[model samples]
Structure formats: C-alpha cells, structure tokens
Target chain A: MTFDVEIVRWHAVASWTWNAGDDVCGICRMPFDGCPPDGKYPGDDSPVVWGVCGHAFHLQCIQKWLQSQAQTDQRCPFCRRAWEFKAAAPSS
Target chain B: MIKLFSVKEKQKKDAAAINNPKQSAGELRMQKDMSELNLAKGTTISFPDGKDKLLHFEIFLKPEDGIYKAGTFHFDFQVPTSYPHEPPKIKCKTKVFHPNIDLDGNICLNILREDWKPVLSINSIIYGLQFLFLDPNPEDPLNKEAAEMLANNKAKFESQVQAAIQRGAYIGSNHFPPCR
Candidate 1:
C-alpha cells in the first residue's frame, strides 16, 4: 500500500494495571488503578501489595489494616494466618 | 440537534456532588461488602433504616440443620466508622436458648472480638452467625448455665433448645421467645 500522507510527529500512548489477583482492594474497596481515600495518586502514591497468603491490597490500605490490630495478634486480613509481605515493594 | 441545558445541568449536579463529597472509607468498604455479601443458606438480611443506611442492619438466620433447626434468630448489626478495622457490634435481637448468646443479646464470637480482620466482610459475620446455630460452642460461651448444660448433657440441651423454639420456655431464670 502506498502512503497518502507523510508521518511527521507521532505520540505513543501506554496503559498499565496492577498484576494482582483481584481488581479492587479488599480493605479500601478501591480499584488498584485508583488511589485510596487518603491517597492522592494511584500508581505512584498508592501501590498494590501482596501477602504471603496470596491476597492483594493497596499498600496504604494494608498498612492501615495492620495498624488497627494489636502487634501480637497481627494477621492477614483475608486469612487468619500470620501476615507476611510477599516482597519488599513493587518497582513502580 | 444539540442540547444546550445538559451542560448547565451537569455542572449543577457536579457542584452538588462536590459539596456532598464522596463517602468515608469505611462506608465505601461497607457498601462493597454488602453488595458482595453471600448469605448462608436459610439466612437473610434486612435494613430497617432503608438501603441508604448501610452501617446498621439486621440478619435473620434460620438454620435448616443441627439443633437450632426451624428457628428464626434475629441479630442486629451496628457497624462502626472504623469497620473492617473494628468488627461490627452484633447483638442477638431474638432471645433464644443459646450458649454463645446471652439473655441480654450479647454474642460471644471470637471473630467479632479478637479475630476480626479487615479482610473479613459482612459475609463472614453472617456465616459465623449461621454456624453458631449449627454448632453452639460451649467451650467459649456467654451463657455459663447453657454452656454447662450443652457440655454435660447433650440430650438435655437438645430438648431445652427445642422447647425454647417450639414454645417460649424458661430454662433457668430467663424466658426465651418462641421463634420459628
């Protein structure tokens, strides 16, 4: 096919989402792409975190969830098992 | 044809929405939980203050099996602003001969007190309430007399439960309501 118009300037667009099992955070009930009630930004400010139990929640949401419980009784919100972070944090 | 007033109306609505603002985190989460709430078999929920009031509601559990079968138990739920973080305050509205439920409607469920976690939703509470009817835990109980009876004499406990459900009977000093 012959090109009718010459290409001068092109702008590329990209999109992304959290690679988590659930679409919405269980704690804040907000979408992973959206920020929590206390957060301002989505991908930058609010990050999705995973537990050793394989449940995913926003970093801020999970932190708040953990802080609500006593230190001795701290456990995963999804499962009653002790909560352990899957990794340090996402690169995003 | 282009609509001229639509933009103005939308702007007015947006302004009103901004004035009202979004619901609090707890309310939002509660709304989500209520929407996704999967009540156990023979369990139903009702909101006395209408749907807008999601924090306060009632659950009616009618266990189809176990000792509490064919009985309708009413439980009142008052969810706090720190819900999920703090478990909802649940009270048994229907008086029954239960070891875990006291005469004053106070319940003795571990999840409602110590084991509550943010991941646990209203569905979890409903299931827990239903389980209490199926298996009344005498190990951790609010009614000491009922607990002792349940632990010591299984036949006596079953008969007492049946009497309480069938005809408002008095076991000890408290009178139970005939709920079926």
Candidate 2:
C-alpha cells in the first residue's frame, strides 16, 4: 500500500506531541492526558494506534467502534481494514 | 553503561505490560462484542491501519436492490471512551442523494439518535441503515421536499430517486454533489 508522506508525518507529529495532557481521545475528542482520578483510560496502558492512512485512537476505542456495528463482518470504521486485536505478549 | 541498559530494559518491560492480555474493562467488553459481529453479504469493514490502533475504522455498504442499488457507500465510525453507554458517531463519507442523508453526508438514522440503546450492537445499526435505503421513511423526513414528493406522489419520488442515482440533479432548492 502507498503511504502519504504528509499524512504520515502529520500523524507522527500528532502521536509524539500528544502529552496525554493535551491529547484528546480520538473518539469523543475528550482529553486523555491525566483523566479524572476516578475515571480511567479506556485501554489502560495499551498504546493508541492510528490506522495506516487514517486518524489515531486507542485499541480499545477502535474495538468498541467495531462492536457497535450491527453486523459481525464489520471492519474498521475508518479505513475499512479488517479489525483484528493483537494477542497479549507472553509473560516472562 | 550499566544504568543505561537497565533503563532501556525497564522501558521495554513497561511497553510489554501495556500490550498485555490483561486489558481494561472497556476493552474486554469491546473484544467480546467485536468477535460476535455478523455483517451482511455486500457490507465489509476495514481498519485502514493495522491491528495496533483501534480507534478509527470504516464500513462499506453496497446496496444490491434498493434505490441505492449498484452503488457503494462508506461510513466512518469513531468510538469514544465511555462506550456501550454512549453511541459511536458515524458519518457517511460518500455523498449520496437520499431524503434521509443530507448534502454534508450526515445520516438521519434513528440508531445514531434518540432511539439508540446501550444494548444495541453494531450489527443492529448496520441493518437499520440498510433498511433505511430499502425503505425510506417519509414520516421523519430529513429532506423535506423528498419526503413530500414520496408522500404525495410515489411515481415522482421513484423518478427523482432514479435521477439522483443517475447523476442528474433533482428539482430541490439544494443541489446534491454527484455520487455517480
């Protein structure tokens, strides 16, 4: 697949610049940095992943998006890529 | 050199934990739900990105036998942190002519609105959207003229739908972007 340099750079900058302080949840546009003491980050410490050619969001966030689909064959809601979750790394 | 190595190893360990199987509650529930999705024949889903990121995705709808038959439509869905309790925001990326869809690609689907329930799954919404094309309800109209035409004159409504699908402009005051 072809990559758009500008788009990639933009998202790269976005990912780096995200301090969780200014980081907004891609789904709700809510701030993710240091959420309320009681409230939690949706994915715990899981790194937020952006679709190759699309916007960024947490893995859990995207998983929720997929689950919301009425059909089981639903793919990613942004780029239409098949949604697959990575297996948990084996513990040492 | 010893200190630097230790720091690097720590960071790697931290990263591993973050990507571990013990996900948050929200993520666990989401996983369970996604594994159970059952889409229709012409519909497909994509991640745009790989499996690492999960926030943004796309849904493609190809209506085989409706006013929108032979046409393809795409919708983008963004899921927020407080899911299940909140509905994902969906936008039609493909501009199409329909009484329920505006020029800006804002869909007038009930599932995305007041009718939404926490129990409603993604499969329900997709079917609801597909049903909209198969049967456009003129009662809760988004495009007033189209609704009125469909309500008052069925023949004119069908013709208008055909014209719009064929890339011809309708008689409405607002002009639609070509979907063909």
Candidate 3:
C-alpha cells in the first residue's frame, strides 16, 4: 500500500573527450561519441586518432584538418608541434 | 546603455539558444571560451546571428593608443566545429590601411597560419589582432605598399593612417571603409 523508490543503479556515461578531459574534439568541436564532420557513426568507420601531443580526435576530423594543412606542412592542431600519429594498435 | 545579462537572464537566454534542439560539443566549448574571455581594454564582442550560432561572431577593437588610436575596427570570427585545434577564420570586416591586414581582409598573423596550436585560446587571437592595430608589422607584409611605407617612412605611414581615418581616402587605390 506504499510506493517506495529504491535507488540501486548509478553510473556515469563519459563521452570520449580529448586529452584535456573535455568531450569535444579540439579541432572540430564535435563530441567523439556522436557523428563526426563526415557524418559517420563512431566505430571502425570513424575511429578516434591520437596525436603525440596527447590530444585525441575523431579520425575523420584530424584527417580533414591534415588535408587542409598538407601544402603548408602537417602540424598538431593543439600544440602546433609536428603531428606524429601515435603507434598503431595491434589488430588481431 | 547596454547591460550584461545576469545568470538568471543568461539561463533564460540559453534556453532560447538551442536552435538545433541538441547542443553540440563545439557550442559548449565556445560558450566556455567566451565566458572566460579576458579581452584587452576597449575591445567588445558581439553575436551577429543571435546566441544560437555561437560559432560565428564579431569582435570590435578600438585601441586607445598607438597608430590605431581612436579608430574602431571590426573583425569577423568564424570558429569551426574543430575549434582550438583549428584556428578561427579571422577577417577584417572594417577595411583599414595596415601592413598585416590586406584589402580583402586577409590577415598575415603567424598564429592564424602555421603557428596555430590547440593550446592557443580565443583570447590569444584577440590580443594578436589588437597588436596588429597598435604596432603594424612591416616584416610580414600583406599590403606591400603599406608595409613599405611603415618600414621605410614612419612619418608618411602615420600621416596616411590619419588621413585615411577621417575622410574614407584611398591607400594605393584600395579604399578603406570609414568605421569611426
């Protein structure tokens, strides 16, 4: 005869934020969890790429920016340092 | 008289800011950057497309001293979704006779080009723009005539800047808009 609400489940959903712990891509400013500038879902088609500067961005986002800076030279959008992609993860 | 909105008013204003229903991550970052903006003296920021479009905005720089004293210059800033990483596109909406700023509003600042790093904030870009007005750089010349005048003849450059201000005069066939 009594309505009692029991608090049982509690969890935090974190968007894959960049190195600064923010949920947005530093260049594109779009969330890593959502659709990228290329309008692709976050998965193998749109994986996240990490820079040596510890900044992370949606693969599509960084690739597009790198293309624009190709004639000038590739530089990290965050630190302006030479953009060195992190070592690739082993595909098994 | 313009009054800055209070927190209560800001919340109400923000409620009307979600034009796309869902606020994008870039918009959130821009909001943070704007709220924490520490602009130099005599500079002001205005949103031309209301508050919904945070990515596009304008900044007005009115330097109190130096070469650009008493002149009001407007710059249009377009922040891409990939902000912080990619520098905001800056253009001199108000034409002026300067070495760094060309007639078509192309800026020759290094930070806007190869020097752009994600670490650089919106504040840094504003400071850079203000510096251009205060001390027009003659080394990296966008307007060759203006740069030549600045580097070779300081007095002539000063006179030209002054002359161009009052009566919308021509600076080497390029007419500057009167923005006093």
Top DockQ model: 1
TM-score against truth, every candidate: 0.85, 0.56, 0.64
| Winner on DockQ (1 vs 3) | 1
Model 3: TM-score, first chain? 0.65
Per residue, candidate 3 scores C-alpha lDDT tens digits across B1-180 of 134457768777878776546655457668768877998778899999997689999999998888778888989999977675578899998888888988888999988987776556788899888888888889969889999999999998887787777667777777765666
- Tens-digit lDDT track of model 1 for B1-180: 246688888899999978985677778888889778888777888999999788899999899999988999998999988776789999999988888998899999888987777778898888888888888999978888999999999899999989899987899988887998
Highest TM-score scorer: 1
* Candidate 3 lDDT by residue in tens digits, A20-88: 356766655556666565555665666777878777777877777788676668877776778878876
Q: Report lDDT (Cα) of residue B62, candidate 3.
A: 91
State model 3's lDDT: 0.77
- Score candidate 2 by DockQ: 0.02
Worst 10-residue stretch by lDDT in candidate 1 chain B? B1-10
Residue A80 CA error for candidate 2 (Å)? 33
Q: Which one is best on lDDT?
A: 1
